[model samples]
Target: MRNKIRIPKRPVDTTMSKTTIPVFIYKPEILRTDRSLVVKNHTVKPVLRTLLFVLTLICITSAAGAQTAEELFNKGLESFKWQKSEEASEYFQQAAQADPNRDIYYLYLGIIYHQSGKLQEAEESYSRGIGLNGGERDRLLLNRGNLRTAVSDYDGASSDYSAVIDAGGPLSSSALLNRANMELNRSSFLLAVGDYTEYLVREPESPQKETIEELLNLLNTRLASDAQAAATAAEQALLEEERRLAEEAARAEEEARRAALMEEALQSLSSSGEDTKSISAGSENIREDFEDSALED
Candidate 1:
């Protein structure tokens, strides 16, 4: 049975068939698990995009904040030009706070404070601005000196003027003039004269030349008159004291002479009294002798 089975032979056929198949693309469903996962991924993508957008916005806002200091300063200047003092002060204050190291900010802040009648605050702002090493430092110092002068702080004003002089700037002439005026007000006449003379020498064509000359002439005349008056007063006082002393000496001499005369008169009277007493006794003795001789006779 195995040999009979082996006698049957298998036929082999080779055939090649070619056919075109159509591919279909369908939209993903949102409700199914896999589709839902894809949708979640898309949703998460949007959330990440939103987060990135927010971060970008934060960065932009930070950059804008960085620029706000200079912008606020310019805005303050515009407000000041418009005579909006309070608004200008507000803007300037914000600018100063935003950029404390900026000399212009502090300087403008000082000006706004001064305009608003905050003199102390203005002085502080000016000082801060001066400390910032800016180009306008001399101007700020001069302004502060003027303010100090307005308050009758002559020494403080002089200090500012001295600083300007030491700095060797264009403001020196005006500062010297102001310093001279301050010295005059404080009655430091000699110092004022020297400063005024120096100022005149430096600025021969100064507009205040006439006024300075007048003040100097007046001070010189007054000082001379005072010296003359003082000398006259001293001479008169010396003469009066001499006259008083002479009169006192004369009175003392007269009292001494009168005392000597009184003593001499008392001595003469005593001698006269003794001589009269002796004569009376002798006359009595003679009369008694005469009576005795008559009785004997």
Candidate 2:
């Protein structure tokens, strides 16, 4: 009996969100110019006050419009935690642009983009963070792998998971499970079995332990059935070959028997011809003796 192994689908939540969503609320810092104006005359003092009020208004506007990169990232985080993905994405994009060197900014951007279902953008953001040598390299790879898997890029997803596993960290066990699922999707049952087994070993207390065990059992059963079928097919082929050889041997034996009978018949015919010639010679000698006796009389 064939057993069907049903691999579970990946959750829609971003990999970073699955780990933890930290909400950071930092006050935005605004840049303002402090200009010291000295009015020599009393008449110019009123004008200076008016000019100061205008400068204060301008500063307020600047403070409202311009936010520091850290502030934007914090806002993005808070928005993401609140499930405001669009708002979070905007803030993350702004933060990344303002502080291009910061890996965390791109990381959040990737997460937001992934949550928003913008796969291409999410991949680009993750790649950017990886290129920057982010401290959360494993997290980036995991998120990218998840995205790649969603898009049916099984090979790329496997590579990303393999990298995370090779790095050997807290996320390695998670990578193992994810890569196993991807392998299953690719119909690589043996590879999936190995990864699932390794993951279970590493994470004995994992929440997915029971489910993974069931899947492993099913896979094992399927593999055993396949092996049995292959063995049966090979045995059948061997029997057919034996039957064909036996038929050929039987035909050769029959041909040899027929050739022997033909040779025996030819030898008998040759012996009969020789006997007939001897009889003829005897008859001729008898006639000659009679003729000689008559002539003498």
Candidate 3:
């Protein structure tokens, strides 16, 4: 018999809260209960980045005034921690509406939507955030690009990543790392190498230094292999073409030789036939003269 753990429902808090977003935290289901659990080692995706900018929102609206946008955003984070994703999204949505100028509201909403598997909503949330015309466009672009990549929108994701790099900020290094990953997936080994090289240059102390180095080495080997394969293919094609041309030339020369032989044979046969005819004609004249002498006798 197997036992099932029931997740408890909690009331949503509408108060201002403070907690750091868990960048690499395990799934909530793991921490809930441990019972007859099959412990298996499975590969998980890595968390790319955390706050390049400190976000501190600890303001709650007074009873006399409406709830502040910061308070709503903080409340959304609290709901998210409690595993109340839908409620959290609502809070973030309200926060976004309350303050159209604040991009953080939309960023939170985007993250929540993305986690909830609402991919279209997630993308639109990021775009909406960017369209708000707020600060830290790089962060928004990075997040959006990651989302796009997750959904297999390679071209759109690539464009966003390139935009991040062109924007020129601390996150540009992260963007480079992401773009390298993109190129790697596409088997553009040399392009990936360039991106990885640039990422290392921009972030000398990158936390992923060892992993990046290993990947770079692997990519270098792959690039060499691919180049060798291409060269071999081209050489083979050239050889095949040369061989075909050589065969054609041989066939043409043989045909020409055959034609010349036939012409020479025909000329020899014609001359022989003409000499035989002249000899026959001389023999016939001698016969006629002998006949005339017999008649005189």
Best by the TM-score measure: 3
* Model 1 C-alpha lDDT per residue in residues 36-102, reported as the tens digit of each score: 3334456444555555445434432343354578876876788789997766777677777888888
lDDT tens per residue, model 3, 163-241 = 9899787888889899899888877788899999998898889899899999999888888888899999999999999
Instruction: Show model 1 residue runs off by greater than 4 Å.
Output: 1-68, 237-297
Worst 10 residues of 1 by lDDT: 1-10
User: Tens-digit lDDT track for model 2 on 1-297?
Assistant: 222222233233341222322222222223344754332455545654555545434432343245677876886788789997866777777777788998888888898888878889999999999888778788999999999999999989999999999999899999999999999998899999999999989999989899999999999999899889999999999999999999999999999999999999999999999999999999999999999999999
Q: Rank the candidates by TM-score, best first.
A: 3, 2, 1
Better of 1 and 2 by lDDT: 2
lDDT of 2 at 3: 27
For each predicted model, how many residue pairs clash, with residues at least 3 apart or on different chains?
Answer: 0, 0, 0
Clashing pairs in 2: none
- TM-scores of the models, in the given order? 0.57, 0.61, 0.68
Number of clashing pairs, model 2? 0
Pairs clashing within candidate 1: none
Rank by lDDT, descending?
2, 1, 3
Off by over 4 Å in 3: 1-68, 268-297
